[model samples]
Target chain A: MQHTDNFQEITHHHDYDREASRKEVIRVTVILTVITLVELALGFWLMSIHQELMRHFIKGLICIFMLAKAFYIVGYFMHLKHELRNMIMTIVVPLLLFVWFIIAFLADGNSYKNLRNKYDPHHVEESKTKVDKPVHGEEHGAKKEGAIE
Target chain B: MAQAVPAEQKWWSGGKSPFNVEYGKLMMWYFLMSDAFTFGAFLISYGTIRFSSNNWPDPNEVFQSFPGLGSGYPLAFVSLMTFILIISSVTMVLAVQAGHAMDKKSVIKYLIWTIIGGLAFLSCQAWEWTHLHHEGAWWGSNPFLNMDGTKASTNFTNFFFTITGFHGFHVFSGVIINIIMLIMTINDVFERRGHYLMIEKAGLYWHFVDLVWVFVFTCFYLI
Candidate 1:
């Protein structure tokens, strides 16, 4: 077979270890499945608890599990872990921006909620009121008068 | 071209790839990174809206329906969807590995499995959206009340449909890319080129889809 120089340039020739790579893939798959199962179990457990603090804690735990799953998918499945360190850094460093992005947005949202509650008592009051029958899209015309009041 | 003179190699001396990967693969990685930011913005906006609201509907109460089994199974159907994507990702990994080994039969087998999984996940999503729409949930309508039985804002359904719809579009496109790759493989395009690098790039995309679903599941369903 004639091997072209263009082919060599376009593809990296790395040493392929069939047995080792297969074993690693299987290990990562198992780890990902177990993490997902644990996350599902926590989610189910969360439904039974009503305490605000407990719910928050479990949600936090679920978030951690979610991150773990992300790690495995990117690291093992995407083969980023096997890439050069420079390549990995380039992909990862930019993602750090999400930290500030999430913090600023969520903090502002909380502040907006507090400000609205303090100034617009009607909005606060309206959100808390319970409807005897939940309104559907089809019933919007019929309930227009009631909804206005 | 081998000159055994230097002790330390210059990785960035401008003759070799600095990252030791092909430019196409590197470009794919960057594209996926940008796509990640797009999703991150959507989810963060969702969290912002949820936090600013006086009360939010519990996802369990909202997504508590499984086809054929009726409603009341909270988090069950979505969990099934999650596993389906994960398993598909595993198949994608296998397909890429097969491509590396130049095993045409194994590559075709795993690619077919991955496509089937993608279609099944899309079907589940279609059923879900239909069921929710029947219950008066749409872009600007929400029939489900908050955990405290209080009225809910339209933002809940808005984000729900928008984010999941966007994600569904990704899955659809990913499947398309995989299908194209399968055809190319069948036609011996990569076999003639003597490398399966194209399949590797597609696998990266497929795995990225699964990664995004992880966060979406946790935020929308689990939490």
Candidate 2:
């Protein structure tokens, strides 16, 4: 029953520290509540701002605040902060790929948007008068090829 | 005879270190990390579509209506829902503390509180979905592409349903597990086993749900 003894030893002070734990939980609750309210306020302010660049800056700030809240929840409540360093990295290092996922997928989607706009019917029809007709002509094609080379 | 039979106690078994955590507990952490990636994929796709589109849906306008408040409240209802989930996380941690102390009474009480908070969040989602339905934005209607009047992307709302619905299901399952733990606490199951690690396991899950909601609220409502 070595494992049983180990668990009991780990939980030994659990009773004596109940009050302290309560205070800690409440402290975290207050901090989270405050941050949430601040995020909401700043979000509304961003919404009201007309400048696009300024709004983007504020949105970035809001993301930072959200990340801070996440840090608190994971570290304190989930007890990850108390865990050993290797275990922490085992969880966090993999999550960095999320940032990569966002960038990679967003880049692909933006390219798709660009492709869609470039091949749009109106633009395609407009370009047909300027470039395609001459490119189909043998003389112009030959001349353009010679000039390019 | 009792004194002669006594043996020395030790924390580690002189074996392989399993992520510096107990086996069952570390596995839960690993499960949560994997779950986080799934949610990460969903949110990343959401951002992809959102940035790719010209006229993305306005979360403020879409989330304006609150029950009994009629309209004009932007993000207020969603904020309240987030608040409830955060506080529930608090209750859950408290329950874990109680379990560590072998205090069954406090465990039952806090678990009930957590369960209530989860139910409240689900109900709020129902009201929000109902409001959207009446406005012609049901599961079938694409919010972004449907330009009848609400300047939104069909892809946006479809992802919204898929992601939030999945998260809500997690919360649903969390509450169910909490209830089972509550019953077990009442039955002295942990007492017989000489520990309350089950409560800690449940706390891990509840906190993970809270953690995911933070991202969802940011991706869905704030950003």
Candidate 3:
């Protein structure tokens, strides 16, 4: 008789636990919807101010906004926040480094492309300057058509 | 009479259960991480090319979807694609919730909804691709095409197709996987366990797919 009563009590407790988890799931869904709506609004707002922002801040603000949305998706939806710190660190630290690398590469690559354009007359005047005058007269100085070879 | 051999002595035991998530989940995590690096590489390469060229067409202009059959006003369909994917993510979350509660009926229903959303997103992407292809934009064949129909750059179209094409393949695979899970759920394979780890894992991958798109959208559309 005692075993039967204990079994009933355990089953009832399990039922309540499942119900609570269901409610939590619904709460999470609502939260995600609200955040995504906010992101949608922000996207439009940025577009409206794009011209002014581009001139003053160079579109970096848009990139920052994108990262913010990404963080919310990963941290909340993916539950990375509840994960072990080591696992979180493993993903986050490397991603941060990679992002920095991309930015550095873009900065350097753009500067180099600019420098090449300024010095390389072939890219600037490819149609008019048919005669290939090696700017430095070096073997590698042979200019290719339409910019970087 | 022989001494009893414990089940632990079996060759398969090896200190782990096959489906208790010891190896499966860990392997999934590793696969996802490597896949992420592949995406990162593509995006980084895209950045390199974008920075190297001048007079490159603004993504906002290039990605504008052809507005009707001949409306002459290109629309930003990428935003619509983003919205579809986000909605699919929500359905996926609901399916995971149902799976956790061992509600096989709701799990199957939500899985079907998620699959439908995936297919719709794929169709929209197909439309976007066909439009780009018709514009004589062979991958890397031309850098740029001016508004007046003159060629601008050859490098532009190359990266355009490569990056987006790679991401599309991931989405296609995701759709297929979800379909399989849906079928399995309907056939009562997952019902045996009273809990669906497969759905949870699929949800993780599906959410990652959405996450990747958000980055792709920002890079190739908004930027």
Candidate 4:
């Protein structure tokens, strides 16, 4: 806590007051632990039961709790709560785009799956009409003839 | 009489760190934020494939194996891992606190505890990976199959390995960094500077690692 050193002289502008930060840390720790416990309880309960009512919202509930834990870690442990508004927004606003990316990809991938399942249950044949001469190469010709036997 | 410099002339027209944090701490936060998006991309992709598939492996059934007790306790082991990482975060906070108070002794003490917690979590992961590999799950195999005989296991196993393995690497690096911090504290490196911002930076990283695990746990195990 002494300002004898030059580094301390420059950056030691604040007193050694960590009491508030310390208390917040402990509180956040307790909160995170409690939230995790609730998630675990819900996890096991839902795992044991197949109630349609619970199933309707279980994924949403799990996600909500997960976000809560994420916020606590970022806001308190990482000390973004005490940071400048500009800084917070700088980090946060850009992340929204990431969420958008997930949604977009999900839509695109599902569309592809639908198309594949609907149009092609199996591989498509290259020819619409039987070839008069035969389409198989010599190796395929021998294998095809052998398979027919 | 000297003229004042133009507004744009100063490297930082400077009020404080743009985030009002130490330059190093702010940089650390930015680094963590970037790292987060990388993890975000991974988990989000995993979720996409999982939901798209007709039948996905039940995480509860998949992760039931526990050490010294084979395959009965669903999530019992990962819950322990979560607790350990959270506890390590707490210790890391205390270490940062001790650093601010210039209590180097307590800082080192708490850091050692943090490192121990990290090691314990890593050991659990190592065991989990080994067990899963033995149980016919690996990068190339996805033992879970959907009705039409299409194996959903391939994407599941591959994503599981890549995502969790990436996370495991972060935890490994975090432990190594914590060890370095511990060494510096013991050697009075921060003591000479008279501030513990170094510990705080390391704490941000360690907490970020835990935070990422929270999502990984939800995506991989809880869901």
Top DockQ hit: 1
State which candidate, 2 or 3, has the greater TM-score.
Answer: 2
- B6: Cα error in model 3, Å: 33
Clash total of candidate 3: 8
In terms of docking quality, how is candidate 4 classified? incorrect
Candidates in order have lDDT scores of 0.86, 0.77, 0.65, 0.76
Best by lDDT, which number?
1
Could you tell me how far off, in angstroms, the CA of residue B49 lies in candidate 3 after the best superposition?
Answer: 1.5
* lDDT tens digits, residue span B192-221, model 3: 644476787788788889888877876766
Give stretches of model 3 more than 4 Å off: A1-58, A125-149, B1-22, B66-75, B142-151
- lDDT per residue as tens, model 1, A1-149: 25444345335445667677789889999999999999999999998999999999999999999889998899889988777677889999999999999999999998999999999989888888997656545544232222111
Which regions of candidate 4 deviate over 4 angstroms?
Answer: A1-16, A51-53, A122-149, B1-12, B15-18, B145-151
Considering just chain B, what TM-score does every model have? 0.96, 0.88, 0.83, 0.90
TM-score of each: 0.93, 0.84, 0.75, 0.83
Alpha-carbon deviation at B127 in model 3, angstroms: 0.7
Candidate 3 chain B, run of 10 with poorest lDDT? B14-23
lDDT of 4 by residue, B61-97 (tens): 7788889987789999999999999999989989877
Model 1's TM-score against the true structure? 0.93
